[model samples]
Target chain A: TQLLEQSPQFLSIQEGENLTVYCNSSSVFSSLQWYRQEPGEGPVLLVTVVTGGEVKKLKRLTFQFGDARKDSSLHITAAQTGDTGLYLCAGARSGNTPLVFGKGTRLSVIA
Target chain B: EPEVTQTPSHQVTQMGQEVILRCVPISNHLYFYWYRQILGQKVEFLVSFYNNEISEKSEIFDDQFSVERPDGSNFTLKIRSTKLEDSAMYFCASRRGFGLVMNTEAFFGQGTRLTVV
Candidate 1:
């Protein structure tokens, strides 16, 4: 089975603090996606990284895929209370395959 | 914008009872999927449906779990015999097309919380 292991299962930081969460795997993926989920709700797609070593930014959130396509990282700059949620990383081996998800990192940003 | 929608935000049922979780995927989406997340657990894929047939399924999708796209727009997941371990948040997702170039982003529904007691 393909597994995506995430680090620091839980995190708590004050507002204006920066944080980085990581997702690593032994297998390579064709694409990787980042999602944020609120309690009792399904995950919301934040970004998708298809190329190795690719970096994408959305407002204060920055996402990067590793050069080997086996890992990825999410960095939050000056996080706010709204950033508090569960961040998940999902990877797809190919276009027609199902996505394998990481355990996720639960982030709590205090204001 | 179009999005996936699920019915019965929450449901509570007795053990061994049957329950059906319903979802309406985006009008233009061609691929559909079912996923479940146990409390404080990672989201796991149950099954994937395309062309009115199951394209892929995980080991977790046993005989007790089944998926159907009865109509053109609605996708349904039925749990024949629920157990205490069946309790989880079930999410339905869909994507527009397949392949590396086309949009592969899957849009997810709000999800249905199933509590089996």
Candidate 2:
């Protein structure tokens, strides 16, 4: 079975701090996606990277896909309390299969 | 932006009972899926539906779980026999197409919290 593992299970930081969350997997994926989820809600897709070595930026958040498509990272610059939430990484294969998720990194920012 | 909507934000059922979760995917989406997340755990895929049939399913999707797109707009997940282990957040998502390249992402619903007693 393919599994995506995310590091730094929990991260607590003061406002304006920078944080980077990593997601790794031994299996190769055709595409990788990053999502943000709040408590009691389903995850919302933040970005999707289909090409190797692709970098996408969404305001203060930047997501990068590994050249080998086996790992990805999310970086948040000058993070604010509003940015606090559980960040999930999902890998997608070909066909109609559902995406697989990582355990996620729960981030909490204190103002 | 269109998003998936699920009914009954929360549900509580006795063991061995039946529970059905309902979802309304995006109007133009063609592929639907059901996923579950135990408390503080990774999201696990259950089933994926396309062209009025189950195109893919995971090992977690056994005889107890069934999905149907009964009509033009609604997708339903029926748990024939609820178990204690079935208590979790069930999320419904839909994609515009069958593959990631053409459609890209799945829009998820808010999720229904199911508690089995």
Candidate 3:
């Protein structure tokens, strides 16, 4: 089975602090996605990275796909309380395959 | 925006009882899936459905678990015999394209919380 290992299982930082979470895998994936889930809710897709060495930014959030297609990262700049949630990284071997998800990083931004 | 929706936000059932979880996928989506997440664990894939049949399923989807798209828009997952281990949050997801493309992103529902007694 393909597994995605995420680092920094839990993080707590004051408002305006920056944080980065990493996701790594031994198997290559055709695509990878980042999601944020709040309590009592399903994961909401934040971004999808398809090409290696690709980088995308959404407001204060930045996502990067590794050059080898086996790793990815999410960086939040000047984080706010709203950024607090569970961040999950998921990979797909192909378009048809189901997603393999990492255990996720629980982030708390204290104001 | 259109989104996947699930019914019965929470459910509680006795062991060995049958339960059917319901989902309404986006009107234009062509692919559907079921996934489960145990408390504090990663989400695991259960099954994928397309073209009126099961396209793929994980080993966790045994004979006790079945999926059906009875009508044109509603997708359902039935657990024949629930056990204590069956307690978890079940999520339904959908995507708009065939599985051959590289960037098909799935939209997930709010999920149903199942508790077995």
User: Taking the candidates one at a time, how many backbone clashes does each contain?
Assistant: 0, 0, 0
Displacement of the residue B33 alpha carbon in candidate 3, Å: 0.6
What lDDT score goes with residue A71 in model 2? Answer: 97
- My TM-score estimates for the predictions, one after another, are 0.98, 0.97, 0.97
Q: TM-score of chain A, model 1?
A: 0.99
Model 2's CAPRI class? medium
| lDDT computed for candidate 1 | 0.94
Ranking by DockQ: 1, 2, 3
lDDT of 1 by residue, A1-111 (tens): 999999889999999999999999999999999999999999999999999999999999999999999999999999999999999999999887888999999999998
Off by over 4 Å in 2: B98-102
Tell me which residue pairs clash in candidate 2: none
TM-score of chain B of each: 0.97, 0.95, 0.95
Model 3 misplacement above 4 A: B98-103
- Candidate 2 residue-wise lDDT, B28-101, digit = tens: 99989999999988999999998899989989899999999998899999999999999999999999974546
True contacts kept of each: 0.76, 0.80, 0.71
Per-residue lDDT of candidate 3, residues B1-117 (tens digit): 988999989999999999999999999888899999999899999999999999999999999999999999999999999999999999999988745342389889999999999
Residue lDDT tens for model 2, A14-102: 99999999999998888888999999999998998888899999999999999999999999999999999999999987545579999
Candidate 3, position A93, lDDT: 92
Q: Name the weakest run of 10 consecutive residues (lDDT summed) in model 2 chain B.
A: B97-106
